[model samples]
Target: MTTQEVANRYIELEKQGRWDLIQEELYSDDIVSIEPDSAAAMGMAKTVKGIDAVKAKGKAFNEGVEEMHGGYCTEPIVGGNFFSVAMGMDVTMKGAGRMKMDEICVFEVKDGKIVKEEFFF
Candidate 1:
């Protein structure tokens, strides 16, 4: 798939809250996920290699979220083999209380599969 096609599929699955399916279908086995430098303070690694590790990171976050008040995912902006989305969520964390989290999610695609995803706040 081209970047635009991947972006569209990502948006569609995200709207359906099916990120797990997206990962399974659209990501490469060696996909990498990167968090901002400051995320280390939150117990997230600066970079995670492999699709399984990426899913584990997401699972950890989900486990820590007590409730989700709201969330939004913007239409993707396609650029060559890359795409970006502006996403945010309001949520209550297990021990951190309620917080509004906003960030830009950028994805890189190659050979019709997502190879990398990086988050910036």
Candidate 2:
């Protein structure tokens, strides 16, 4: 798949909240995930390497949420092998109270798989 194809499929799965499927189908084995430094305060690593670790990180995040009120993922803007999307969510965390968070997520595609993803809030 081309980067545009990957981006479209990502948006499709994202709209359905099918994160597991997105990762399973689109991520490269050696994928890298990067979070902002401030994420460390929320018990998230600044960087995660490998698809397994990334999946674990996503699982941990989902586990931390007490309730998901709503969320949105914007259509991706593709350029070269990179695509970017704006995503936001309103959720209640296990220990933290309900809050709304928004972020810009950028993904790099190579060989029809997402090789890197970085988030900025």
Candidate 3:
């Protein structure tokens, strides 16, 4: 799959809310995930390396959520091996109150798999 193909599939799965499938199918084994520095206060590392670590991070995040009200992922804009999308979610956290979180996510694809992902809020 080309970068465009991967981006399209990502958007498709994102719309379906199949995040597990997205990681399982589209992420490279050595994928790297980067979060903003402020995420450290939320108990998230600034950078997570490898697919397993990334999966664990996602699992932890989902576990921390009390309730999910809604979420959205905009259409991806692909350039070279990179694609970006604006994503947002409205959710209630376990300890924190309900909030709306919005971020721009950029993904880098190599060999038809996502090699890296970085988020900015």
lDDT of 1 by residue, 1-121 (tens): 8999999999999999998999999999999999999999988899999988999999999999999999999999999999999999999999999999999999999999999999998
RMSD, candidate 1, Å: 0.6
State residue 57's C-alpha deviation in candidate 2, in Å. Answer: 0.3
Per-model root-mean-square deviation over C-alphas: 0.6, 0.5, 0.5
- Which 10-residue window of candidate 2 scores lowest in summed lDDT? 12-21
Which lDDT tens digits does candidate 3 get at residues 1-121? 9999999999999888899999999999999999999999999999999999999999999999999999889999999999999999999999899999999999999999999999998
Each model's C-alpha lDDT? 0.95, 0.97, 0.97
Cα displacement (angstroms), candidate 1, residue 12, comes to 0.1
Residue 94 error, candidate 3, Å: 0.5
How many clashes show up in model 1? 0
Poorly placed runs, candidate 1 (over 4 Å): none
lDDT of 3: 0.97
Candidate 1 overall Cα lDDT vs. reference? 0.95
Clashes of each: 0, 0, 0
Candidate 3: C-alpha RMSD to true structure equals 0.5
- Could you give candidate 2's per-residue lDDT for residues 38-68 as a string of tens digits? 9999989999999999999998998999999
